[model samples]
Target: MENRINNITYDDMKVFFINKVKELKSWPYNGKNVVIAPLPEHVTVNPDKPSMFCFTEINDDYMEFRRSAFWLVSGTVVMAFMISMMSIAYLAIAVCFFYDGSFESTLFLCFFGSFFGLYVLPMAARIAFFIPHDLPVRLNRKTQKVYIASLILHGNIFRLRPELIFQEMDWKYIEGWVLHRSVGKGTPYYGLHLVENKSGDINRLQQACLYRTGAPWSTSEMEYQINNIMSTWSYCQHFMNYLPVPDETEKDKNFVFLSNNWLFKWPEAMDKASRSSG
Candidate 1:
C-alpha cells in the first residue's frame, strides 16, 4: 500500500478520487468533477460577444477573512453598547429606590438589567452580525480583473459585494480579471455576482450565473440570464483578459509586467528580481 501511494502522481490521485465518487453514485459537492476546457491559445476579436473576456470564481480565504472581521467589529460594538446601557439602567433604579424607597422594585430592575446585558443583548447582536453583507471575488493571476459572486456563509445569509480588498500595491501588481462591471451615471462602483458551472458537461458548456445586490439600476436578474447564454461561446482564455482600471478608459496602457523568474520559490538572491526589473 505504501509503495502504491508513493507511485501515485497528483493528477492520478485526482482521477482516483473521482472514480471512487462515481462508484458511490453521489454527486460531488460543488460539482468538483466538472472539467473545464484548457485556456485558449490565441486571442480572437469577436464583435458579437461584448462580455467574452469576463469570467469569475470565488476566493475562499478572502471571504473567510471578511466574515471574521465583520463579526469582530459588530460583536465588540454591540457588547460595549449593551454593557453601558445596563450600567445606566442600574443607576436609574438605584435613584428610584433612594426616592420612593421601593427596595423590591429596585432589586427587580437590577436583576433584569443584568440579564439583558449578559444574555439578550449578546444573542441579538450575534444574530445581527451573522447576516450576510459581502460576496467573494477571485482574481486570475494572468488578468488583473475582479469577479463577483454571491457567497453563502455556512449555508446561511448571502453576501453581495464583489470588491477586491487587496492592498494597492498587490492590486497594481496582481494579474487577473474581475468578474463584475462598474455601473453608475458618471462613476459607478463595480457589481459582483456569484456563478456556478453546470454538471456532467465536461466542456463547461453549461453555466449558471446568479446576481443578488441591494443596489438598483444595476444589472437585473433577467440580464444575467441572458448574459450567461452568451458565456457558452466564450473561450476560457478570453476570461483571462484582465486589463487594469486605467486601461479601461486610457489609450496608452503602461503595465508592470511579471517576469518568469518570479514564478517559483527562490533563495534570497533570487528574490531581488522583483526590484531588479519592471
Candidate 2:
C-alpha cells in the first residue's frame, strides 16, 4: 500500500518553505542575504571571505609530550651534573685544606656551584618551551552567502564556542552566523565562551562552535538553529551597512583570527541585543 505520509505535495512543500521563511524573519542576521553553513564532510571552506565561518584545532599533544620528556631529561642531567661538580669541587677543596689549607680554592668551588645551579640550570630549562601548533578556520565567500570549514590537527579534537568571537567583532562587517551546536528540541541557542587571542589577550568576538557529545544538540542541529536565529533577529543588517575603517596596521597583527578593532573594542552589538530582548 502507498504510504500517505510519504506523499507530500508540491503545495505542501511551498507552504513549509513559506513557514520556514517566516520563522527566520524574527531571528538575528535576518536582514542580510548572506547565509553561513558548515562544509560537508571531506570538503573545506574557502579562505577569501572575512565574514565566513571557519575553524581550526590547536594541537598540543605531541608538543606537550616532547616538552615534558625534554624537561625531565634536561632537568635530570643538570641536577646530576651540578651535584657531581659540587661534590668533586668540595672533595678537592677538602684535600687542599688538609694538604696546604687553601681557603681560596674552597670559596671558588662554592661560587662556581651556585652560579651554575642558579643561572645555567634555568637557561637549560628554557630550551624545552615549545609553541603549540595552530589550527586554521577556512572560509569562502559566495555572491550572497559564506561557506566554512575547520582544519584542525589530527591529535587536537576539542569543542569550542564561537559566539565569544562574534561578540568582539565589528558586527557591521560580518553578515553571517557561524554554525553553532544547539540544545533541546525547542529553538537552539548558540553557546558563547570567552577565549584568549593569539597575543595572550582575552577577547569574546569569535563566531564558531565545536561538537560536544554532552551538549543537548549535535553540531549540524546547532547550525540549523543558528540559521533560524539569524533569520529571525536580522543580526546581519549592521555588518552589511557600516564596514569598519582600520585604525592601525600594527595593532591588527596582534590577533590570531579577528581584526584588531574587533578584538579590542567592546561588544556593542551584544548590548543592543540585550536591550532589545529586554
> Could you say which candidate leads in lDDT?
1
Question: Candidate 1, residues 104-135: lDDT per residue as tens digits?
Answer: 76677667666665655554343333333332
What lDDT score goes with residue 216 in model 2?
A: 24
Give the TM-scores of the predictions, in the order they appear: 0.29, 0.18
CA lDDT for candidate 2: 0.27
Report clashes for each candidate as comma-separated counts: 17, 29
Model 2 Cα lDDT, one tens digit per residue, 210-240: 2211122456854553443333222122222
Candidate 2 residues lying further than 4 Å off, grouped into runs, are: 1-101, 129-278
Query: What lDDT does candidate 1 reach at residue 246?
Result: 15
Residue 255 lDDT in model 1?
18
Q: Give me the candidate number with maximum TM-score.
A: 1
